[model samples]
Target: MSGSRKYVRHLSTLVTFSVATLVVAACAPTSAPSGAVAQNNHTDSVLTVGLPGSLSTLDVAHEAGILNYYVAQVSSEGLLGVDTEGKIVPALAEKWKTTDGRTWVFTLREGAKFQDGTQVTTDDVLFSLDIARDPERSPSTAVYWAEGTQVEKTGEREITITLPEPSVNFDWTVTASGGLWITSRAFYEAAQSYGSSSDLIMGTGPYRAVEFQADSHATFERVDTWWGKTNEKAPKKIEFDFFSDESTRLLAQQSGKLDISLQIPASQQPQYEALSNTQVTTVTDRSYVGLTFDTAVAPFDDIHVRRAIAYAVDRNSIVSSVLNGKGEVATSIESPEQLGSHIGVESARSLIAQNLADIQTASFDMEAARAELAQSVVPQGFSAELLYPTSIPELGTAALAIAENLKSLGIELTVTGKPVEQWITTLGTGEYGLSYMSYTPTTGDPAEITGWLLGESNPARYSQSDVRQLITEQAGEVDDAARATKILEATKIALNDVIYSPIWWGKNTTAFASRVLHPEINSYFFMSGWASQIGLTDSQN
Candidate 1:
């Protein structure tokens, strides 16, 4: 790991589903707006966004979906905010530094106030961080910021954090998600209620929530007294209307009722591009769609069995048919493009190319796969079930392909498709033998995702002491050279272990009406919380 290249930590983890398990009603929309209005047609200053699902909650601690984060980003300010380039930027904290590797100090900005007009102070920061760190209080945040950490008010506008151990990701965790969003202690204690139907959440953000209707809709109005930059006509109001169906969301965009729409299926991208009034922004996310083998299970417990499946699956064919050639065949579980890892895509490719000469042009070697399977405990493969969620068609399709390939190897693979909720429950309880999963990078550091896979609670029940130690060391190793070395060692071990087989890295697409002009749109931090920067164009471009 050299300082010359950014060491990227992609939060894009093994799961792409909204972390929130909010159940959405199945009732279809009764009506939709008319066809797209002309680009020059100036309507009200409201920006109607077609959300893929209803928001679960306004409270960051309660929900992990990007939709809720969208609301939180507008309605609250964290100690830090993620810029479009995936860089951590100052939000409430104007500057932060560390005197010792285990301790950090943050200086708050002057004159910052919450949406309710309450002044933000060091006490509020302490309160918010404490809750975020407590497992019983905020499960979503506890994973990012470890519990038992100490916080002290060092000055009127400064606070200090003392970690039990040196953690390079401490600041990244604070800035990674809305969970670190600073909230008024007075308001939370008095209200004792947040993320309800009434949408009574307060923060020091650029917008304030005015209306929230569960999974139906939520609306926010710009904060006139916001401490951030804004324009009078630049989306004075932003409304998120949940449309669970992709077709309905597409219709909303085409009908001009939606100024922005997210997570549009890739198969429909061509149709959307043909529309004259829509502008689509896309990136091949660091997220990977793959299969996780439960190492605790009999067959997968054998490394030979795992390697057999990896060799049998035709990743190129899946990318071509399922992903429509919009993805890259994953060479490793971690996205090759992670810059924060110091060894970026170019470096990764060069290294992989050098180490594995045949990787550059490899094909499915069924014979090789069969040989590996023969080395397993069961030379004659046994029947097993492979699970996938119906929400992502690509996963199911790829699983089907893998099933077909496995059949030739004397393996009776049963592919099971479940709805998002049931699938999540099944995974949580370890009810399946094999699974096709997705991973999304949530932070600028690779350790977040890498460390998670190696964590004790990993659903796959896969662990190797040597690899685990390497990943654990890389987590707190601030020295770039040492961290990179540890990451490489762990990655090599993981590759050899073959605990999981990666298929492809999918592209994330966001479509907006032609009139919208967003200067920088990124896959990181996703499409949430852009109301303050979204501007309007006089003509379609």
Candidate 2:
């Protein structure tokens, strides 16, 4: 989430949400399928994943961002990968040795071959890194390398990266989903094109870019001569069908056309499940959905006001209707699944136990919310336009619900929905007072959500300096135990600050035809993370 500094700590947090377990029991384990016809033969088969947003471009290097993550993976390899359990795994690099907190030596796997048949060399690693660490070439979120960076090939299989200051998350940072990627030093420098067209995108991964159609679609094909066989679940081919509307996407899934789609109409889960040849894969994720108040402004600067709006707002109905009871409504950014081991399944159990009575859950109490609203300077009938991004239907409902809730609290709120691009531009410029959005921590590490989302200088203009300092100290700590303690401590401190009314933690939802694979069931929909680990049954068609 930090704009600067790449890489994330290989984190391992326990999750106890029963959503995955329940979905599997309801859908799979049936005696079904016959041969490759009944069972899915992912081997050499083409699999396509759907994207809700439009793809801006295929220029992986210059247009690197989350919306472009799936595209980047087709052409590059990260030094490391964050596994399903949040543990860091070796990818392009075999392993790394940390001399101090500032320097790292990575040992590459010998004979690692690129798509072009060139053996991966230390120079290639260095060359690719030099680009990522360079502002002129890399699209890395952080520009920290401008401070002081020493990158060199120390040996045939060894590379060293030295930083000026301690970047506790540096080792993991370089491998942030879009940060670490391998490019041939020779081809990288000589190549005039980036990922603009399929011809320009190349990588050592099992699949390589073959077709790119801008916003319409993109296709990938298996590298028959790929070097790694360990990735058994890797698809032989992948095609992404882009659709801005949720209805068309869901229709594609029902028609047995799309192999998988992330946007399953929450209300249509049952209809899809009833299909004899359909399997819906749902997972638990470290995603959050909450109301962000402009803490930097007055009226909302008071924690009581934030709490009043939260208490008045009924999140349960929204969860049941909008999320189809598939999500865990968040009482805070940190959900029970993320902290379930430490306590129970309540959203704010670890953060605000003593203040539980004051903070409302998904359920709303109009009376209590109104009393707090009276304390505010809101004129007898103060009303403001609540901005909602029309790109996401959930935000629209959220805006509507929020507006209705505030009215009960004596603060009339008008809901106005707009496209994401317009909403972002207006929100950033402070034209919109309040809006709805989701938070997905780049790193599943607890500090990620708490540190960035609640910190001051947040694009939302919510600044709490005291909370921000705690986040910094915790992030800077190198020790494992100390970092954990600091993270939890910070969580408690920030949530109790009541800067914003935490609503619900977002859920990772996806619909797969019953005949497809149920790979790794988890809350990370975007990653569908364990797709490679999944063994699919044959498609009924």
Q: After superposition, how far is residue 398 of candidate 1 from its true place, in Å?
A: 2.0
lDDT by residue for model 1 (104-129), tens: 88888899888877788788888888
Which lDDT values do the candidates have, in the order given? 0.63, 0.54
lDDT of 2 at 7: 9
lDDT of 1 at 299: 74
Highest-TM-score candidate: 1
Consecutive 10-residue window with the lowest summed lDDT within model 2: 10-19
lDDT of 2 at 57: 52
lDDT of 1 at 432: 65
Q: What is the lDDT of residue 348 in candidate 1?
A: 59
* Per-prediction TM-score to the true structure, in the order listed: 0.84, 0.77
lDDT of 1 at 5: 6
